[model samples]
Target: MTPKRVLVAYGTKHGATAGIAEQIGTSLREDGLDAVVLPADDVDDVRDYDAVVLGGALYAGHWSRKAKRCAERNADSLKHRPVYLFSSGPLDSSAEQQDVPPVPAVAQQMERLGAREHATFGGSVTAQTPGLMARVLVRSGKAGDFRNPERIQSWAHHISAELATLP
Candidate 1:
């Protein structure tokens, strides 16, 4: 049988969310799925995939607009497939400590898309990140990479297992 095709798309500023998406794609691949990672802006269709993973970066308690627009644009197609959502932000260990709920907009998107689940992963703000605020935060020793590869891989593998049980 052909491996399941999964689309892992993300909306990011300063590239943190993109990294998370890549990690998901890698993990899914390890689980024997055909995963493709792309920027949310470039995700024009979801009909070609068996499952979809959509994620975004959070800013001021709001999910990224790019991610929202991707979901809105692909809503009809996404609803027919098993869909998952994620958020990458919270430059702290809070996500590791507890289940962080999706922001309101993301919750609405999840309901609209019939997404199966949502995960919140910690974000990063390294010196290499672009933008004045990011640099300032890094310089102030206030920001660091909090994304955990183990957690991300665990989520992806879980998705892969769930997909195996689906029709």
Candidate 2:
């Protein structure tokens, strides 16, 4: 059977979220779903997709504005399909679940999107990554990468299964 189409959209300041989205898109395709990965700002419409995966880099406990806008702009179509939200943040080694908490921005749009799943995964931060301002912030201990590959793959699996079950 021809697989359903899935759009994996993401916003990233330092490429980490983009990388995550790539992994997710690849995983979905591998599982026999037709997945297209693109930057959130680049998606013109969500009408063709059977499912939408929106992801963004987290800074100061917020998802990027573009990703948020994508969700808002496509709210009507998204509500009629399966939607998933993922955020990247909380890289401090000291954080477990209690320390990292949850993604607040995603929470605000969850009900509106009728999101089937929401995930908060660790992101990557390197000395060479981020722009000047972001680098400075990271050096100042205000920003960090908290991406987790295992958790990402797990989430991908669940989403792939969900798409498989779609009619």
Model 1 lDDT tens row, 1-167: 99999999999988989999999999999999999999999999889999999999999899999999999999999999999999999989999999999999999999999999999999999888888989888888989999999999999999999999998
Whose TM-score is greatest here? Answer: 1
Q: Pull out the clashing pairs in model 1.
A: none
Q: What TM-score does each of the candidates earn?
A: 0.97, 0.88
Model 2 TM-score, all chains together: 0.88
Cα miss at 47, model 2 (Å)?
1.0
Error of 1 at 48 (Å): 0.5
Per-model CA lDDT versus the true structure? 0.95, 0.82
Model 2's alpha-carbon lDDT is 0.82
Best by lDDT: 1
